[model samples]
Target: MDNPSLFEQLGGERELRTIIDEFVDRVFDDVMIGFFFQRASRERLKAKEYEFAAEHLGGPVTYSGRPIAQAHAAHPIMGGQFMRRLRILEEVLEAHDVSPAVREHWLAHTEGLRAMVTRDSGGRCDPVDAMKRVQERGKE
Candidate 1:
């Protein structure tokens, strides 16, 4: 059995970048979250996503700017919003035909960041509820 780290399972930076790109594209189309990205460009967001993935996957830290928590501190996203983003992210992964093992691996790795991200988003979100939604989704 191949017990690869989530980073290895994801095929390293290139594959992670691809996944983030695809996921962000879907986010751009989501009416609820799209507005949040109105002032951002795909390229910039892509770079940010890449940095985030790299950091979480135990790779070199490419994100050297302000911490995510401070950056999104004013965004009023709550548990429901986080759930919505997760749903969209999952949909993108599925649509892109990402392998189930790889998808699950990455999701598991990234799941821990929910509280950090939401809290940084100004505590507008309920971490407990966000965790519940993540658990519920995992059951599907």
Candidate 2:
């Protein structure tokens, strides 16, 4: 028989939910990539995250999130910030004891989105803050 899908091997929706939760928490606590997600809703983010991961891993779910470029439009995201987020996910997977092969598959899926995630790269950043102040005065 063919090998189980990565979604199945990784334990499906339940495990994905756990991973997404931990990933979100870590991202929020991270100095590098937290600002971009500070105003986001945990529930909505988890939903989109689960859908995206599930679909990408060959699960029977469809992702309803905006296209990558559209989703990140006008954001001051950079390659380093994207890599920071990627590192958080990698750590989460390692914490979950994901096998080496599975981790490679998941990471490969992530690397595929670098273009969209780093579309706004190549800007100089403030060393003192290391963050973009893209938040409007009243967007809070």
Candidate 3:
């Protein structure tokens, strides 16, 4: 039998939406990174984040947001900021009691996007390759 996709493992759209809703609120209100989203629409960001996560997690959803690189290009994000966002995500995941496998995959996928989101790649980020992996995630 084929393995269940990550989306299924994550409890489908309803549960995923619940998780994303909380995560987005926390991210938007985060003292360390909330400034980045001061001008952004909370509702729109939530929608896009839901789409993005749904797609990557193997749901039958498409992310309609702009490409990651283009979307984040206007921001002057640093490595520390990126790491802070990851920490926030980690905490959110733990609070939600996300399955270990799903949590690791999601975090790794976000880490892979660091190059596209920030400039401190440490010479290891290849945004192109990362996007390719993201596009291929649900297929596996």
Candidate 4:
């Protein structure tokens, strides 16, 4: 048999959705990254996340969202926030019993996407505080 795609290795669409559901839930509860997701519709977000993951993992789905950088540019996401979210992902994958090789492959792909996801070079500034500072700077 031909080698399985990463999407298949990770259990295809249904299983991936389960993982993303829990992953997004964990993210919503996290203080550092939760600030950025306060208004997210979990249902909608799950679909979009699955599509993005499917496309990246060589699945059959096409990702129809905006470009990654354009999508994240609205947020002042620090490098630290990105790392925190990634750790949450690792935890979720571990909980789901995904294999180590698959997890590492997934992590490497995601880590490579950091530049596109993070607009802030600053590490760990509270996004709300960062925005306030920008407004304060403009007032001066």
Candidate 5:
């Protein structure tokens, strides 16, 4: 048999939705990054997240939302916020018992979208430094 796609490896749509639901919920509630989403629609966020992940994982869905950069253009997301969101995703994946392969692929894909989502280069910034940068940038 041919190898299953990452979507199939993830138990397909229902399972992926479950994971995304929890992930989005945590993101909306996260102290570090929650404010960014305060004015956004939770359901819309979940739906768009599902489409994005589904398409990337080789499912039969395509993302129909705004481009990543356009979608985030208004948000002054800092490296700290981006990294916090990534950590939340990692925790959610671990909690859902996602396989290592899927976890790695998902994380890598997310990291690749960082530039489109934020000007901040995230992985290097410790929390204090990231906050400092955010504050400094706000003054510019």
Candidate 6:
């Protein structure tokens, strides 16, 4: 049999939605990163989260909002906040029992967006620095 697409690996859009919802819920509860999403409407954010996961999982890209960089451009730079959010997101995925391969794939895809999002957010934060911080934290 041919290898399954990432979308299939993730159990399609419904499963992706479940994962996204769980992950975003964790993000919302996080004191360090919750502020970034504080003003966003819950339903709208949930929909966007589903769309983003669908796109990343190799499903249709229905995310019609501004590019991530543009969307985050106005957020303030908070030292290691972005990295902290990523760590939280990873933990959330793990808590949901996402497969290792699927989690790794999603993390790799998200890492590519860091530079664009950070630069767009009007933050001088370096993506490399953020990545380093995450790695350092993982070691502790």
Best by TM-score: 5
Identify the runs in model 3 with alpha carbons over 4 angstroms from their true place. 122-140
Runs of candidate 1 with Cα error greater than 4 angstroms are 1-4, 97-102, 119-140
TM-score of 3: 0.84
Model 2 pairs in collision: none
Question: Please, what's the RMSD in Å of model 2?
Answer: 8.7
RMSD of each: 6.7, 8.7, 10.9, 7.6, 5.6, 5.3
Per-residue alpha-carbon lDDT of candidate 4 for residues 109-133, written as tens digits (9 for 90 to 100): 8888888888775354455677899
**Residues 41-122, candidate 2, lDDT per residue (tens digit)?**
8789888988998998889999999998889876778767777777899999999998887789889888778777675543
**Could you tally the backbone clashes for each prediction?**
1, 0, 0, 0, 0, 2
Point out the worst 10-residue segment of candidate 4 by lDDT.
120-129
Give the Å error, residue 100, model 5: 0.8
Error of 4 at 3 (Å): 0.8
Mark the 10 consecutive residues where model 6 has the least summed lDDT.
118-127
Give the clashing residue pairs of candidate 4, or none. Answer: none
Error of 5 at 102 (Å): 0.7
User: What is candidate 3's CA lDDT for residue 69?
Assistant: 94
Residues 71-121, model 6: lDDT tens digits: 877986343676767787788778877889989998888776777666334
Candidates' C-alpha lDDT: 0.72, 0.82, 0.87, 0.84, 0.90, 0.76
Q: Could you tell which candidate, 1 or 4, scores higher by lDDT? A: 4
Of the pair 5 and 6, which is ahead by TM-score? 5
Runs in model 6 deviating more than 4 A are: 119-140
Q: What TM-score against the true fold does each predicted structure earn?
A: 0.69, 0.82, 0.84, 0.82, 0.87, 0.77
Candidate 4 wrong stretches, greater than 4 Å: 122-140
Which has the better TM-score: candidate 1, or candidate 6?
A: 6
